[model samples]
Structures are given as structure tokens and as C-alpha cells.
Target: MAVLLHRLGLGAYRHRKLVLGIWLAVLAALVTCAGVFGGKLDDRFTVPGTESQRALDTLGRTLPEASGAGAQIVFTAPEGHHVTEARYTAAIAGAEAAAVKAPQVKAVMGPNVSGAVSADRSTAIVQVQYSVQRAEIRPSSLDVIERAAAAAEKNGLRTSVGGSAYGSNGVHIGPSEIIGVGVALLVLVVTFGSLLAAGMSLLPALLGVAVGLAGLLALTPAVSISSTAVTLALMLGLAVGIDYILFILSRHRRQLARGTDPQESIALATGTAGSAVVFAGSTVIIALAALSVIGIPFLTVMGLGAAGAVLVAVLAAITLLPALAGFAGTRLTPKSGGKQAQRSAAPDGSDGRATLGARWVRTVVAKPLLTVLAATGVLVALALPAADLRLALPDNGSAPVASAERKAYDTVSDEFGPGFNGPLLVLTETHDRPGAQAGAKAARELRDLKGIKAVLPPQPTHDSAQTVIQVMPETGPDSPRTARLVRDIRAAAPGIGEATGATVAVTGATAVNIDVSDRLSDSLLPFTAIVVGLSLILLTMVFRSLVIPLKAAVGFLLSVGASLGTVVALFQWGRLADILGLAHTGPVVSFLPVILIGVLFGLAMDYEVFLVSGMREEWVHTGAARASVTDGARHSVRVVTAAALIMFTVFAGFFPLDDALIKPIAFALAVGVAIDAFAVRLTLVPAVLALAGRHAWWLPAWLDRVLPDLDVEGTRLQKASRVVHREPERVS
Candidate 1:
């Protein structure tokens, strides 16, 4: 496959130009389509049975007649006062009027009187419940709530609205995109000094984003994809797309500098580096596909988006790129081979000689233990911050945004209702026995809750014949108070449901958040296991060594831990809140870890592949472990560093994105790449391999028989039939 792809220079000049043009045209067309459909991508996902579907089912069965999408809106003033009759009445009237005209809203019943207003007149809660008359009450739900706030403002009240839909909107997308891009670009710019090369590095990245978005947008009609999903796509696309391209470009650059004929270099690159690119791309693709097992509609969408991007990126890197490189020739590296570049004096120093990339291998064999400890310490230090990780959703409206508007939210809430900006959702379902009055008691009990301001009169579902109860609490959505309400309700549900012979499932803004946290916990173990296991298998295949695979896997984990710990310490547990642009550590975005693992594992392995592949290749020529380690690192240092920089730059770009989830993931990798590429893979991995020597390739005879051999050393394929024969050319 690689051989065929690398043959672009076989054609004449006109054909080469034509082929390049065709690829550009194809890219342009794909990107144009992607732009048209990219806006709808999102990250807000739902656990398969426990998310939207579950809530919908319970609602459908419970109130066949009472068909309205239930939503919560909290109102606030200040904390220490009594509410006069006039003020309370006016607030209620305004809230009611606002709800009536809001899109998707069926009715507005309350400022239902209660403690929901808080002991002081500082806060009040309003229940705005809606019937699904048009689209599902998702993103648009908050728009209507905002419009209602405008209405209430006209009357004399301040408002802070939070709901599942609204909170998703507020997640910080900036950090992820900005950080990811920033980090990736930083690496790329450093790797390839010319802006053009860096720009080229981004080509696959841009395409991945375009295709991932368009495909995800297309899926919205049939699947429940959340707004948060796009952030995942954006992050993954940048990381993989850029890194994959880096691998090919480095190999191509090497061949060009060696003065190989353009056609020969193209083939050798494709047959060698390009093959690794294919396998790496495939690994990421398969890993992403495994997310389908998560039982999460949102995660599945994210998986599909990432997997699609990887597939496209792999194709572009191997096929389109080789053709372009073949067309560019020496121009791509006119000055690269010069000594000023601090380039490795590969033995064949000038174009075609044997290179001394074998030196680093010899050094490692001399001092194995020192090498291993240094690498281990570096990784361990990085993982330290992970232990302090605080998993909480940031209340920057929803995710993380340093927007003035987002900041203004805190001031408004503090002045009016301390808890007004964050709130929780409560879902109530009842059983239909001859007499199941559990639903009624749940409603009455809801009205009596201390922090709640009003409980709407229980309305029988116009669609499901079940009952719907709406309660407004003093805290708005996204607040700890709201989270407490959700927990309290759950604690209370068992007794209430038993008494009524009914089932009550709490699902609202706060409830969903709690659910997300719970679900994340449930998902993390499996996510870790799968990613670690798969990465180990891939590594084992690459090196044919059990101990080495285990070591790499452990190193990967340490990197993950270090990154998380740093983020948590800065953003949550450690309280470097100012540096992180965090007002305070609220809950970390619920999905960050799962998404982080998905991305970080692949990136860590990238360096792993670079270091190990080179070392393994060296081993083929000379079986000395030390020789292989030193030689491999010496050879791989430039290319891997360049690739890592590009990745880091791309990650950093997302720092300006509005979402917070990206920051940790991107920053972790940004720091992690440095550690993995420079310390672990370059220094530690090689040293360890040196110590292990032949054991790095040791496998039980029986196991070896069962496992297939992986040959990453495609060097022999570099010589074509022409290069192979020194005899006089045969007449055609």
C-alpha cells in the first residue's frame, strides 16, 4: 500500500502538476462542504439508557396526558430580608407573563410561595414548564429563558437562568481549541521554521475539523449529539492530524536531504514512514470506535467524529502529501541539510552515506539504570498534580469562558440571589396501580422543601397521562445549592416513591450534572482499561516485548496523572485559579477525563512510536540494546521534537476557545509531549531498553509463535529495482 502511494514522481511534469491540482481541488471541495455543515457540532452528550432517552421514556409513560418539556428558572434579589406582598406579587406576575410568550413554554404558574425565595427577600424562584410543541427543549430552551429574563427585567426583578441546555452553552470551548492549537503550533513552528511548512502541517488538521464537524452535523437528525461533542472533535483532529503529517514530512525531508531522486524518496517515505502513519492512524481510529461501547449517545457521536477525522487525515498524509512532496523536490529543504540546523551528523552525513544515528544507542547501553531513573522521576513529577484533581463543572455560565459577559454573571448573582445563576432539575415519575398517589405526595413534599420558592400545581401529562411537578429553588442553575437540591431530592425520593408505589427519577440541570459526575466515574475505569490495554497491545506489536509494553503503558499513565494533577492544582485543588482564569474551582467539566484519556494516550504513543521505532530499526542492524537506544534517540530527536511542537502549537491555539475542558487536556499534553518526547521516549525508554538489551525483543517461544511479527523497519524498500541493480541496464 505504501509503495503504490509513494510512486507519484513516476509521471511526467505535466502529470505531476495535474495530480497536485486535483488533490487541491478535492481538498477545497471537502472543506467547503465541511464549512457549510460545521456549526452544529456539540459536546453535550447523554449516557445511553440513563440520559435523554431514559428521561423521555419515563415522562412518556408517566403522564401520557401531561405533555410538556419541564424546565427550571430561578430568580434572586439579596439574602437578608423579608419579601413584602407587593414585591412578591409583582415578581410572580412578571415571571408568569414571561413564560406565556416564551417559545416551547406551555404555561407559567409560580412564584409559588415558599422558602425558595430564601429567608430574606434577596431571592425568589419561578417554575417555567413547557410542552414540546416544536423541537425538543434543548439549546433553544435557554434562549426562551433569556427572553423571559428580559421580560422580568422590565418589571423590577433580576434573573439568572440555568438549565441542562443553558449549562452546556457555558462550557469553556476557548481553552481546548486555543490550548490544543497553541501547543501544537508551538511544536510545529519550532520543528519546521518556515511558516509554509507549519502551514502544511495544519492542512490535515483543518480537513479533519471540517469533515468531523460536517459529518457530526449530518448526524444530528438521527442522533442526539450534544454541543460539547464538537470540542472533542476539534481537539482530537488537531492532535492526530498534525502529528500524523509530521511523521511523513520528517521522513520525506530526510530523503530529500540525502539527495535521493524525488521519485525514490517518495516511494521510500511511503513504504517506510508512511506505513507507520497508517498503523498509528488505524490505532487511533479503532480506539475511538471502541467508545461506541460507552452507552452514551454523545460519546458515540464524539467517537465517530474523531474516528472519521483520523481516517481522512491518514489518507491525506500518505497519498496527497507524497504527491505534493514529489512535486516540490529540493525546495522543501533547500537549506535544511546545512550544518547550521544543528542536524544529526547521520554517518552518511552528506546525502547518501551511512549515518551515525547509532551513537545514542551505544551511550544508553553504558548507563542503563541512570537512564531509567531519570525518565521515571520526570514522569512521576508530572503525574503528581493529577492526584489533586478536583472533578467539578465550572460555573462559567456552563463550561469555561472568560468572557466579560460570563464574568458579569458572577457579579449579578452575588448582588441579587447568591444562588440564582445555578439550579437543578427534578424529574418525577409515578406507577399506575389501582391507586398510586405517590406522584401527588412527591409534589406536596416538593412544595415544602426549605430552599424552594414555589411548587407548580401538579399537572397531569397531557401526553403520557402521568403527572409533572415543577419546583423552583432559590439557587439558579449551575450552583452548588442546585446540586444539593438534586441530591436531597434523590435522598427523599425512595420514601416518597414507596409510599406512593411510584418511581421518581431526578433529572434536571443539577441532577444531570450529578448524573454526569456519577456517569463519568462509572465510565472512567473502563475507559482507562480500554485505552491502556489497547495502547499496550499496539506497543507490544511494535516492539514484540511484554516488559517494554508494560513500561510504556505505565509511563503513559504517569504522564496522564501529572497533567491532570497540574490542571487540578491550578484550576481546582491547588487554587492557582487566577493563572487558570478561574474565579473559583467549581466542578471540573464532567467529561474532561474521558476525553483527555482518548486524546492523551494517542499522543503519548506518538513519541513512544518515534523512539521505539528508531531504536528497533537500529537493533535490526546491530543487536546491542545500548547501541539501539542511543542511536534511535539521536536519530528521532529532531523529528519527534518537531512533531511534538506542532502538536503543542495546535493545542495552545485552543487556549482562546471558550471551553475549559480543552485547557487541561491541551495543557496536559503540551507539558506531557515535552516529557514524553524529551524525557521518557528519548532518554528513559532507550536507557531501559539498553538495560533490557535483547529482552526488549524477548518473547516466550510459544507466545512468539502465536503473535505476528511487526516490521516497522521498511528501510530496505527504499531501494528500487533500479537502485538494486548496478549491472548495465537491460534494454526494454
Candidate 2:
């Protein structure tokens, strides 16, 4: 692998223009094609076999009009006035006029026309049914309805809109990317101390991110990826892209400072650091690919998109970075003669020198148990909030207060009831007259059930073989009470279905969220076990140690737990909700843990491989555990911390994104990377390795014989160094 990468780097350095041109061509092609063929991205996920999905399928086949997205134009009359008053009549009139102007609208049921009014007569709902699913409705198509709502508001009545269609406005790139880039530029310049070198590391990464996003957009027509997938891709792409470049660039500059020729330095760096880049990137790709095992389409697309971005970033690092390095010449080297300059140029603490990184390692090694205990205590304290962690889909309760959906939710909950915001549909399939009669009887009985606010009359389908009953619960969708209510309804469904000789399902927006929450919770254990197991196997192969992989796995879980617990405290428990502008305290996004586990686990392994591989290399060469620990930490600390800082910044930039879903993801990744870098990688890993001593490298003889040897650091580059030096023994 070292020889092959060395040769490739040599070729790229020799034909630098050609290599650069190929990347540029790829970028141009991606941009042009994606622009022409790109389709809109959305989150139109449905869990197969879930009651909500079953209800949708049945509706699509039997009552096609009912299958499309439904929007509620909620209206509230002025103080002490009823909706039937003439003052509110203009608002309804304007809405009716707008409905007539709107396209793809199947029907509109107004309060005056259909008598859909609240019990207080102060609130009324105008139900607009569209001809297509919410996923199929473009944001622009909903603007006509919005304009009508605005016109209605001009009257003496208060008006708001809510539904899946109103919920999805056009998604745009937020200021987070720009903010991330600005911060990255600062970190790169400070780290490299050379404008040309800093730009070299950053430019290729930005281009790779561009290509990745373009390719992802181009895939939208062929594959329906979630809209948020693009944001996630951008966040991850920038991070890995910059970090990959940082790895190779730092190594190349170190070789240049050692008086190696530019081309040779680039080759050796690519052969060594580039190999780690490949391994780390592959680990991330494998981890993300495991998301497919969950059997969720949106999640599969998200994983694929993120993995593809990482792949592009890796390719750019190995190919474009080396080619660009050829033009950098001596500018990659730090200036000589000053204290700061000397320290910056000292990549590996030469002349048996002890740098701060080395000093910290020694201090930790001196009292490994105490260091480990302190770090573990900090992580445990942060993770304590996770004991109360709750998971649910982000509903209107979590949406922006000014958003149409939130406003509509507030208006409806205040005027009609909170239950009116998310009504459950009780669907029953029957084959005989007695069955339909029994279904009606069951619907009437639902009114007497606890937590149910109202049970609408059962309406039979065209064939009279199916009956649909709307059941309104007392609580909102995000409430724990709502989830309990759903469970109660489902439990009672079996007995009712049996008595009616029919199949009954609890299906609605709230029901779908419950189903998703249950699936994510159930799948969390198996999914985590699989990812952790795979990471263990991979780390074991690279480090050639049982104890090493076990420790790394524990550290990874600790970082993940601490990060999630922080999210729970801030977002779920609302410890600082008012300051963050959160609408209310509620469950974390249902899929957040699943997404965080995949991303954070992969990122954790990235640091693990980079740090441990260096230590393992030192241990192999010197046969001294403490010296290797100190040496490796001193050598890799700057690069890993810099990489972590860049990643944290990139993720933090996403805070400007208005989407409730994207914010939690951004927070999790940013906090996770911070904890992993500072607490786990720097503090816990060294301490644990120091205490483990020789056992850190211990693998059973038989296990070693059976396991394939994978040298991620390209140690065989020592032989290649001999060829470059023209001396067999002076390879180093």
C-alpha cells in the first residue's frame, strides 16, 4: 500500500497540472449536470408496516382524494365575537377566493359552507385538501394559500395555516457554511503559519465539498433523499475534507522542514499520512453504510450522501493535495530562529526534547489511574442527564414560534383544543354488515375511553367494507401523554378488532411519530452493538490489541453519552430553553441518536486510529511503552486538536439553520467532537494506554496468526525511504 501510494503521489507531483485539471473537470461536470438535472430534496419517509403507513396505503387505493396533504386554515374571531359574525365573514370570503385561485386543490371545506366550527363558535377551520401528497407539493404551490391567509388576516379575524405543506418552506444554505469557512481559515493560517500552505489545505477541501454537494443534488431525482441530508452532507464534507488535507499537508510541511525536496516530501507524506487518511475515511464510510441495516429509506439515503461526500473528500486529499504541494515549494516550511517558530516547526520533539504535549502525556502516565478516574467522572456527570433522555419526532411544539405551523398550532390549541392540533384516525377494515355495525359501536365506545376528547361518527367507505373514525386526544403530539394515549388505543384496538371481525389501526401524524420513536428506540441497541462491534474489529486489526479496542470503544461511548446528555439538558429538559429561543421543552428528535451514533462513532474511530497508530508505531520501533505513549501524543496532538476544532466549528455554524431537526444534529455533532477530542482522545486515551502498558499491544498468538495485518500508517515507507536516501541502514 505504501509503495503504491508513493508511486501515485510521485506521478501526481510530476503531472501536477494534469492531476489538478482532472479534479477541476470533475467539479465542473458535477456542477453543470447537477444544475440541469437536480430535483428537489424532501423528507418523505414512511415506515413500512406501521399503522400510519397502512392507513395511507388503504386510503390511496380506496379514497384517492383523502390520500393527499391536508392544510387547515384556522381562524379566530375578535374578542367576545363568534366566527359567524359578519366581521369574520370577510376573512372566510377572502380564503374562499384564494382557494379558487389555487391549483392542485382538490376541495375546500369552509366553516360557513361545511359547518366546521369549534364548540365556542369563536374559532373555525377551513380544510383545504390538495391533489398530491405533502412530499409532492412544492413550497411555491403553497404560497397561494399563504397569500390568502395573509388577506384573511387583513380582516378582523386572526388566521394561521398548518400542515405538512405549510411546514416545508424552501430549504436554503444557511450562513453556517460561511461562518465555518471563516473560522477554518483562521485555524489553518494559525496552524500552518504560511498563507500559501493554509490556503492549499483549505482550497481543495472547499472544492471537494462543492463537488460532493453537486453530486448529492444530482442524485435527488434518482433517489429521494431528505432535504436535511444536504445540510448534513455539507457539515461532514467540510470537516473531513479539511481534516484530510490537514493530515497530509502537516506531514508534507514537516518533511520539508527536515530539508527534503518538495516532490519527495509530498510523496512521503502521501505514502504515510495519506494512508491514514484512506483508512480513517474508509472507517467513516463503513460506519455510515451500517445505517442501511436499519432498513429506513430516508436514513439510507442520508448515510449514502454523507459517505459519498467523505469519499470525495478523501480522494481530493490524496490526489489534489499532493499535486498542489508541488507548487508550494519552501513556503511550506516555518521560518527559523524564533521561539514560537521553532516550537511550531518541531513536529516530533526532536533531540529528545520534551514539548508540552509530551509533558502532559508524562504527567498522565505518572498517575494513570487518577487521570482516568477524573476523566471518567467528568464524562459520567455530563451523561447523567441521559438517564432522563426522551425521543420523539420534532412537532409544531418545537418549531419556530413565528413559523406558520407553530402559529396555527397555538391558535388551534388555544381556541379549539390541543387535541385538535393532532387528531388520530381510527381505521377499520370490515367485510360484512355486522362488522361495520360493530365498528360503529366501537367508535361510540371510544368516546368513553380515557384521554380521548372526542370520537367522531364512523363513516363507512364507498364499498361499506371500511370505516374511518377520527379520535381526538386531550394532549398535543409532543406530550408524553399523547404517546401513552397511542399505546392505549393500540392495545384496545385488538379487542375491538376481534369483536368487530375487522382489522383496526391507530393512524395519524401523531401515530406515525409514535411508531418512528418506537422503532428508533428499539433499533438503538442492536444498531449501536453492530457499529461498536465493527469498530472494535477494525481497531483491533489496526492496533493489533484486544485491550486497545476495548478502551477505545468505551471512550467513544462516553463521548457520545456525554454529548447526548448535554443535548437532553439543553433541548429536551429546557434547562436554558428561553435563551436558545426554543418553543418548549420536549423529546429529542427521534432519529437524532441513530444519526449521532453513526457519525460520532465514525469520528471517534478517526481520532483513535490516528493517535493509536502513531503510538503503536513508536512502541514497535523502541519497545518501551511509556516512551512510545509520550512520543506519539507529542507528535499527533496538534494535528488532532486542530482537526477537532475545525470540525466543531463547521458543525457549530449550522446553528443559524432554522429547521428544528437540523439544530439538534448540529448541536450533537459539535458537542460530541469537542468532548471526544478534549476529554476522550487527549485525556482518557493516554491515561488508559499508560496503565495498560504492554497489555495494550497484547493479542493472542493464534488470533494474531488468523487476523489479517493492516498497516494504516504505511510503515513499509521505511524501505521506500531507503531507496530515496541511497543507503540501506539510514532510512529514518
Candidate 3:
């Protein structure tokens, strides 16, 4: 592996201009194609085979009106005025009439028709039903509704338009994202101590992200890409792109600072660090691509999209970074002074005055048990809040406070009830014409169920073979009570079916969200098992050690638990919500735990491989595990620290964005990176290694024989180089 990477790196370096040109051309073509052919991102969340989704699909065929996108234009009369009064009636009626004339609107139900008036009669809902799904509903259809609402506001009615049809599905890149890139650039400059090197590091990362994102968007014309997928891809692409470059470039500069030939150094660096990059990237890609096994379409897209981006990042790091380094030549070599020169002069890179990493590792090894217990204790304490963690998909109530959707959601909750925003559509499909009364009977049963706020009269289809019953829950869409109600209704399906001789299925935006959440929840444990099991196998193969991989997995879980606990506290419990700019709090996004496990597992392995490989490499040479832990950490800690910080800043930058979907995910990744890198990988890993001593690298002979030589530490390349150098000396 190292030899192949060495030749590839040398080839790229030799033909630097060609490599640069090819990459630029590819990026340009991808961007142009995306700009011309990319379709809009869809935010519609659907899970096939789930009861809610199956019901919705059935409705699409048997009763299109109920399956199509829905919207609500909530109108509030002036204080001391009722919407039913003659003065306010005209404006409400006018808005309803306009909504009826709107393009793609199949039906418009006013307060009088739908009985949607608030108890105070000061608020009313004009329900608009479109003849298309949310993704298919044109923006013009929503514009027409908004225009009517705006006109009605002139008559002293406060109006807001919102529903499944509203809200943006496009990924927004704001100043926060740019600021993240800027911070990453600063970290690179500081790490390399050269503006030229920093520019070289950031250039390839930017290009990789551009190419990856463009390619993703280009496929949108054929594939239904979600905004969350795009955001996740962007986040992973940029962070991994820079970190991968950092790994290879830092190795190259260190070799150059030690007076190695610049070209030879680039090749060796690529062979060594690039090998780790490939393995690390593969772990991430595998973890992400494993999302496919769950069989959820949107999640599959997200995982695959992010995996593709990481693949691009790995390619650019090995190919483009080395080519760019070829252009920079020996200038990337550190000056003959300061810590760089000092460390370069040392045979083990840990000789000179003790650096922070060296001192820290020595102290850790001095009292390994204490360090382990303390770090583990801190992580466990942080993870305590995870016990109370609840999972649910976001709704308009969780939207930005100033957004029209949020305003509408708030108004509906304040006036009518929170359930009005997320009423369940209970569909009763009768097998026989004699069972037409099943709809009425089902409605009665639903109303009698606990958590029932209001059950509208069932509306039968023209054929009377099916009926749509709107059942409102007492709580909001994101409420746990609402989720319980959904489950309760489904649990009663068998009873309802036997009594009415009809199949009962519940679906709506709210019910679908609940079903999606439940699906994700059920998949979490198995997905985690897969990721952890894969991590054990991959890390064992890479490190050729049993204890090391076990330690890495345990540390990864600690970081993940701590990160998730923090998210639950801040995002779910609303602790420090004001400081974080969170406008509302509810259950954590359903897919977050699964995403965190996959993403953080890969990232934790990244730190593990880079840091532990150094220790293993040192041990292989010196055969002293304790000294290897300290010395290896000394060599790798700086680069790993910078990489972790770069990742943290990049992920953290997205946290402050107004995107509810992206915010918690970004924050979780950021926190996970920080905790894993600083605490688990750097601190706990060294302690465990120290405690294990020589046993840390122990692998049964048969197990070792079974594992292929991955050469992640470039041991083969180093040995081959030594043999080549000795051959000339022997001849002399």
C-alpha cells in the first residue's frame, strides 16, 4: 500500500502542472454541470414500509386530495374583534376565495366549512390543499397563498402562511460557514508557520469541497437530494479535506525540516501519512455507506453523499496536495530555528526540552489509572443527560422564530391548539360497501382514546370505500405525547379492523414525522453495533493489536455519549438555549444519534490511527511500549491537535446557522471531535497504552497471521528505503 502510494505521489509531483490542470478542469466541469442541471433539494421526509408512509401512499392512489401537500393560512382578528363578525368576515372570505383560485389548490376550507375557528373566534384557519406532494408543489402556489394573506392583513387581520408546503429545502451557506473556513485557514497557517503552506493546504480542501458538492448537486436532477444531505456533505467534505491535507503536508514539512530531499520527503510523506489517510477515509466511507443497510431512502442519500465527499477529500489529499507541494518545493521546509528545527534534530522527535505533549504523556503514564478513571468519570457524568434524550423530527415550531412557518405555528398553537398544526389523518379502508360506517366508528374510537383533543367528522371518498378522519392530539407535533398517541392509534388498528371490517392506517405530516422518528430509533442500536463491530475489525487490522482497538472503541463510545448528552441537554432540554441562539427546544432530531455514531466513529478512528500508529511505529522500532507511548505522542500530538481543532471549528461554524436540521448535527460533531481528540484519543489512549505496557501491542500469532499487512505506519516503505540505502554502501 505504501509503495503504491509512494510511486503515485512521486508521479503526481513529477507532473505537477498536469495534475493541477486536470483537477481544475474536473472541478470546473462539475460546477458548470451542477449550475445548469441541478434540481431543487427536497425536504420531504418519507419512510417506505412504515404504517404512516404506506397509508400515505395508499391515499395517493385512492384519495389524492388527502395525500397532496397541505397548507394553512392562519388569520388573527384585531383585539376585541372576532373573525365571525361582519367586519372581519369579508377579509377572511376574500383570503379563502383567493386561496381557492390559487394554482394547484384542489380545495380551500374556511372556518365555516372546516370548523377551524378558535374558541374565542378571534383566530381562524384557511386550510389549502394542493394537488401535489410537498416536493412537487410549485413555489408559485405558495406565493399565491402568501399574496392573499398579505392582502387580508390590510383589513386588520394578522396572517401567516405555513404548513408542509412551506419552508426552504436549499442548504444555506452564510457568513458562519465562511468564518469556519477562515478559522481553518488560520489553524493551518499556525500549524505550518508559513502563509504559503497554509494557502497550499486550504486550496486543495476548497477545490475538493467544490467538486464534491457540485457533483452531488448535478445528480439532483435524477435523484431527490435533501437539504440535510447537502449540508452534511458540505460539512464533512470541507473538514476532512483540510484535515487530510494537514496530515500529509505536516509529514512532508517535518521530513524536509530534517534535511531530507524535498521530492523524496513528499513521496515518503505521501506513502506514510497518505496510507493512513486512505485507511482512515475508508473507515469513514464504510461507516457512512453502512447507512444503506437500514433501508431508509433519505438517510441512505445522506450517508452516501457524505461518504462520496470524504472519498473525494482522500483523493485530493494524496494526489492534489502532493502536486501542490511540488510547486512549493523546499519552501515548505521549516526554518532552522524554534521547535520545528529542535524536534527535527532529535532521533525520536522527543529529545530536546519537553514539549507539552511529551510532558502530558509522561504525567499520564506516571499515574495511568488515575488519568483513566478521571477522564472516564468526566465523560460518564456528561453522558448522564442522555438517559432523558428524546428523538423526533423537527417541525415548523422548531423553525427560526422569525420565519413565516414558525409564526404560523405559534399563532395556531396560541389560538386554537398545538394539535391544530399537526392533525392526524386516520384512513379507514373498507373492503365491502356495507362497511361504509367504519369511518364513523373509527372516528369515535379515536376520539375516545387518551390524548385526543378533537376528532373531525370523517369525510368519505366518492366510492365510499375509504374515509379520511382528521384526529387532533392534545399536544404539539414534537411532543412525546403526540408520538405516544400515534403509536396508540396504530396499536388499536387490529381492533378497529375487526370491528369495522376495514383496515385502519394513520398518516399525516405529524404521524409521518413520528413514524420516521420511530424507524430511526429502532435502527440506532443495530447501526451502532455494525459501526462498532466494523471499527474493531478495521482498527485491529490497522494496528495489528487487540487491546489498542478495544481501547479505541471504548474511548469512542465515551466521546459519543458525552457529545450526545450535551446535545440532549442544550437542544432538547433547552439549557443555555439563549446563548446558543436556539429559538425553541424539543426532542433531538431523530436521525442525529445514528448520524453521530457513524460520523464520530469514523472520526474517532481517524485520531486513533494517526496517534496510535505513531506509538505502534515507535514500539516496533524500540520494543519499549511505555517510552513508545510518550515519544510517539510527542511526534503526532501537534498535527492531531491541529486537525481536531480544524474539524471542531468547521463543524462548530455551522452550529450558529438558522437551520434547525443542521444546527444540532453540527454542534454534536464539533463537540464529539473536541472531546474525542483532546480527552479520549490524546489522554485516555496514552494512559491505557501505559497501563498495558508491552501487552498493548499483543496479538495472537494466528490472529496476526490472518490479518493482512496494511502498512498504515509506512513500516514497509521505511524498511525498503533502508535496504536501498545500504545496497549502495555495501557496493562502496
Best by lDDT: 3
Error of 1 at 711 (Å): 1.9
**Considering every candidate listed, which one attains the maximal TM-score?**
3
- Per-residue C-alpha lDDT of model 3 across residues 1-732, encoded as one tens digit per residue: 899999999999999999999999998999898989988887778888988899888777777878888899999988998888886889989998989888899889998999998998889999999868777887788889999999999998999989888866788799999999899999988887788889999999989999999999999999889999999999999999999999999888888877778888899999999999998999999999998888789999999999999999999999999899899998888777866656766776744688777788889889999999999999999999999989988888888999999999999999888988888999898875744588888887787799999999988765568899999889999999998998899899999888778889899788988988888888988988888888889888988899998998888889989999999999988999998789889899999998899899888988898999889888988999899999888888888999999999999999988888999999999999999999999899999999999999999999999998787878889788779767988999
Residue-level lDDT of model 1, residues 1-732, one tens digit each, is 445544532442226567557656765765665456533434343454554336645664554213344444555543343334576457656666766676666555464542345455565556565555113655555566667766665555556554333433422445445555665666666666555666666765576556555565556555655555555566666667777777777666665665666676666666677777777777777767777776666567767777776787776676656656655666666366454132422452223432333354455457789867766776677567666544545544534444433534554355445444443334555445432255577777776666775565555554333455656667765455665776777777787777666666665444555566667768888889999999878877677778789888887777667667666666556365665565445555666777667666776776777667777777878887666666566667667767766666666655545455555555555666666665666566767776777888786778777776665545545545336643445533
Clashes of 1: 132
Q: Predictions ranked by TM-score, top down?
A: 3, 2, 1
Residue 227 CA displacement from its true place in model 2, Å: 1.0
Q: Which stretches of candidate 1 lie over 4 Å from their true place?
A: 1-44, 51-56, 60-95, 110-116, 132-162, 165-199, 204-208, 340-345, 348-367, 381-436, 442-459, 463-465, 468-498, 719-732
Instruction: Give per-residue CA lDDT, model 2, range 340-409, as digits (tens).
Output: 2565456563334665666777788889999999999999999999998888887665678888788887
| lDDT of model 1, residue 277 | 78
Residue clash pairs of candidate 3: none
Per-candidate TM vs. native? 0.82, 0.95, 0.98
Cα-based lDDT at residue 195, candidate 3: 88
| Each model's lDDT | 0.61, 0.82, 0.89
Q: Flag the better candidate by lDDT, 1 or 3.
A: 3
